[model samples]
Target: MRTLTTRAKVAWAVITVVVLVWALLPVVSIIATSFKLPSQLNLGTFWPKTWTTTNYEQIFAGSAKDLFLPALRNSIGISLIATFVAVVLATLAAYAIARLDFRGKKLILTTALGVSIFPVISIVTPLFNLWRNIGLYDTWLGLIIPYLSLTLPISIWTLAAFFRQIPWELEQAAQVDGATSWQAFRKAIVPLAAPGVFTTALIAFFIAWNDFVYGISLTSTSAARPVPAALAFFTGASQFEEPTGAISAAAVVVTIPVVILVLLFQRQIVSGLTQGAVKG
Candidate 1:
């Protein structure tokens, strides 16, 4: 690798710092606000003069728990279920799309592309009425089903791209060595595709977890409302008080799982995304 000149290195460092600040500003602001006292909320600075954990305390040990905890559980359950279903279905469909030859394959892919890009707001109204008619409104299943529409197309696309890079010869070679079809697939093909599947699951989970419009528009109660929507309804100490600190605290709390998830699986995510980028 060639070394960068001093001027080029300086320019790159400045760009990196700018990008990092731009990306992390909101998160940092949320974290900083979460630790601020209610009186210091509008201090017009990043850090608080008198830090307090009252917002977190309220969320965890007070009445807010009734709303926050249930919503947290709903978010976790819904996102996990959506991710599992989306990843499984996407894997099968991706394998077929990448390896099989069939009529209208391009059409199916094009349809998926269209559906994925379709504005979700346009359907919320019709889906709201349809879900109420079908008895699925205000239910976890209601959210999970809609989340699939958002997640499936991207999952299919990503997994299909990654699947194309895998060598089918490995599966055939395993079969020739007396392995059964299932065994060969599980032991040979799956290992190669696991990173892609994992990456897809992460993507699906994030999509489901961060969903706000559906979480709010589809559910009226905490019974099915997720953390994102629940946070919107958080009440402050009094009617006149702003829930900014509580909102920030809740935001920080919800973000922890995502941070942990990325920290744990970042290597797999990077490998999956870059799997087909370089050929040697």
Candidate 2:
């Protein structure tokens, strides 16, 4: 690598600091607002005049119709189930595309890629009708199936790229040692693909957690509504007023798990992204 000039290095450092502040400003604002009392927030400054936990206490006091807790539980349950199902199905599908030489494979891969490019609105109506007929409407299963449409293609594509990077000779050698295809895959391929699997699961989890359109359009009851759907209640047409501080508190609550997941998987995400780009 060539050394950078002093001017170039200084300019790059300035750009990095600018970008970091740009990205973090909104997040810092949200967290700061969440800790303020409703009265303190009216002052309109970056920092709160008074810090209090009443916002969080009110949320846990069985007020707010228990919306916060239920929404939290629904989001976690749906995201975990959807992520598990999507990752398993995607892994198998990707393995076949990467390792097998079947007819129509190219067409299948192309179609999967095409599906990923389509917007969710394009099929929302049809999916709603189908779920209604099957009696899965407004149910966790209903939400899960639709979430698969959002997550599956991307998961398959990510895993397929990773699978292709593994040396073919390893699988061939396992076969020569009297292991069946499935056995060789389980014993050798799966372990090597752990990082990719974790990356796919993280993507699926976030997609399911953050989804709003289908969650709102399909579920009519609060019992089945996730955090994204529940957050809508904070905004009312008659703005006599909902507490901005409380809404910010709820947002902070919903964001915590996602932030934790990203931090925990930061290394894997970086590795998977670089590996996929370089290998594919």
How far residue 187's Cα lies from its native spot in candidate 2, in Å, is: 4.4
TM-score list, all predictions: 0.92, 0.87
Candidate 1 collision pairs: none
Candidate 2 lDDT over residue span 1-280, tens digit each: 9999999999999999999899788988988988887666768799877888767776666355377788778778887898899899989988898889998777866777788778888778998899889988888988888888877877887788888877867766898999999988778776887878889788767778889988887787766788888888654213665557667788888888778878888887776666544556
Determine which window of 10 residues in candidate 1 has minimal summed lDDT. 271-280
Q: What C-alpha lDDT values do all the predictions have?
A: 0.87, 0.79
What is the lDDT for 81 in model 1?
96
Which regions of candidate 2 fall more than 4 Å away from where they truly are? 1-9, 174-187, 235-240, 271-279
- Can you tell me which runs of candidate 1 are displaced by over 4 Å? 263-280
Query: Roughly what TM-score does model 2 have, to 2 decimal places?
Result: 0.87
Give lDDT tens digits, candidate 1, residues 1-280.
9999999999999999999999889888899999999988877988988989998998988758888889999999999999899889988888898899988778867877887888999979999999999999999999999998888887787788788888989999999999999999999998988878888888778888889989999999888999999998998888989988888889999998798888898887666545423321
Error of 2 at 170 (Å): 1.7
